[model samples]
Target: MLDWSKATKYSGILQLYRNLIELRRNKQKNTRGLMGQNIRVFHTNDQTKVIAYHRWMEGGPGDDVIVVANFSTQSFDSYTIGFPNSGTWELRFNSDWKGYCEDFTNKGYSTTAHEGECDGLPCQGNVGLGPYSLIILSQ
Candidate 1:
């Protein structure tokens, strides 16, 4: 067990959880999709231990959110993932960011969707992913 007395409020894991909670509950950020009922699981690769899904309200621009996770032990410099629309997607959160933890390998960035057919989606984007990490992107 962990010692609660030694747990500081400034700990990386604590901050990470706070950030995620704020992201999910803050309505002013236009992230209602995280609270919405619409969801689509678009990609799942057992070999690579990766899975991706989309969450949206009405879908488009500020109302859409895409989540991708890597469960493997290896990292990828460039992994193609599908997007619902063709445009710039902002990197809202990255689980592997060094600020979240000292041992994390900071990877993942905002990417623009390009013209292509991938994972049954109309647009595709290449993103860097760290091992056992997840990234959240939004428009």
Candidate 2:
């Protein structure tokens, strides 16, 4: 068992913070303050993963950020995202691969809720995103 509060752990993301781009067999971890940057990423372990939470780099100037979530769930290529101020956002990427929208209703994301981004958009503090899907938000 490793300590997540002591030091940085690369067990959950593709890029360790923002420096390295690949994960060695035995060594891999990410750090804090790595909330910005655009780079290639590849991280996975069996069926479980560390990238549990989705983020938007907080509130600031819009910089291009690509997050590829390789989890188990349905995804949307088109939807709305509410910014900090109070406006709906547009989707730039979505799941092109199959096997993403399974059990979405069971997970509470029924088609009616996802009816053309008409559903309530997530606030900045609680942004909604897809699983195992690549998301690119640029400005």
Candidate 3:
């Protein structure tokens, strides 16, 4: 049986995922990040061959932003990401949908994704990701 701690962790992750979804719906995002001119997109079409997926070029100003998608119908069992430490982080965009929450001045949540600055991490909190969902972050 799964450990009780893991179950709590999963629940916490789900909550964060939900917050991301809600935040995405309520904010606007920055386009292209620091490397919009040379943006790289990551996605998949085949689930079975994901183990041998093609690798793409990676190198940027460290302030550059990244976007990722699952592409497959099945959800990811687990995944990892690496980023340079700078400050608090927030998910501002997703591949599945457009974001507009940052434009709080408008008739929206009155919050901006690109304007957020956490403590170099996602609140050191749980994270959940849904199928075909995209994840965007800011420094």
Candidate 4:
């Protein structure tokens, strides 16, 4: 059996789950895009073991969300990926945050979409990715 006592402590795995679950279900924070059905896979790199996708409810600034996951052990300082439109994207969640695990490097940040073509999209942005980590971004 798992040790519930240890998990209930601050900055433990349970807290991480609570944070993630709260964000995914938060309506007041405009994170409901994660709960929407619209999704589009925009980027995928087999060699790097990375994939990126966009999720939206009605699509637009407040309802759009981008998710990137790194499945490899290698981390990237800046991985270029596509965005549906040009603007700012906020880094809402990073799985590598030290709050979840003391050893995590916490590599991930917000990015601004520039006028460039990437993964067949008109706008592109660069973001950090930690080893075996995932990140969520929103407009």
Candidate 2 pairs with clashing backbones: 9-29, 9-30, 10-28, 10-29, 10-30, 69-132, 70-132, 71-132, 74-100, 74-101
For 11-109, candidate 2 gives per-residue lDDT tens digits of: 323122221232111122221113533233323334433132223334333422323343555443433333222332233333322223332221112
lDDT string, candidate 1, 1-139, tens digits: 8666645844888777777887687445756678778999999999999999999888777778999999999998889989988989888888899998888899889899988988999999988899999988888
How do the candidates rank by lDDT, highest first? 4, 1, 3, 2
lDDT score, candidate 3, position 40:
38
Candidate 4 lDDT for residue 36? 85
The TM-score of predicted model 4 comes to 0.91
lDDT of candidate 4 at residue 83, scale 0 to 100: 90
Worst 10 residues of 4 by lDDT: 4-13
Q: Is candidate 1 or candidate 4 better by lDDT?
A: 4
Q: Candidate 1: lDDT of 1?
A: 86
> Which ten contiguous residues of candidate 1 have the minimum total lDDT?
23-32
Which segments of candidate 1 are over 4 A away from where they belong? 1-4
Clashing pairs in 4: none
Residue 118 displacement in candidate 2 (angstroms): 20
- Report every candidate's CA lDDT: 0.86, 0.31, 0.37, 0.88
> Candidate 1: global Cα-lDDT?
0.86
Question: Which parts of model 4 have CA positions greater than 4 angstroms off?
Answer: 1-3
What's the CA error at residue 12 for candidate 2, in Å?
A: 28
Worst 10 residues of 3 by lDDT: 103-112
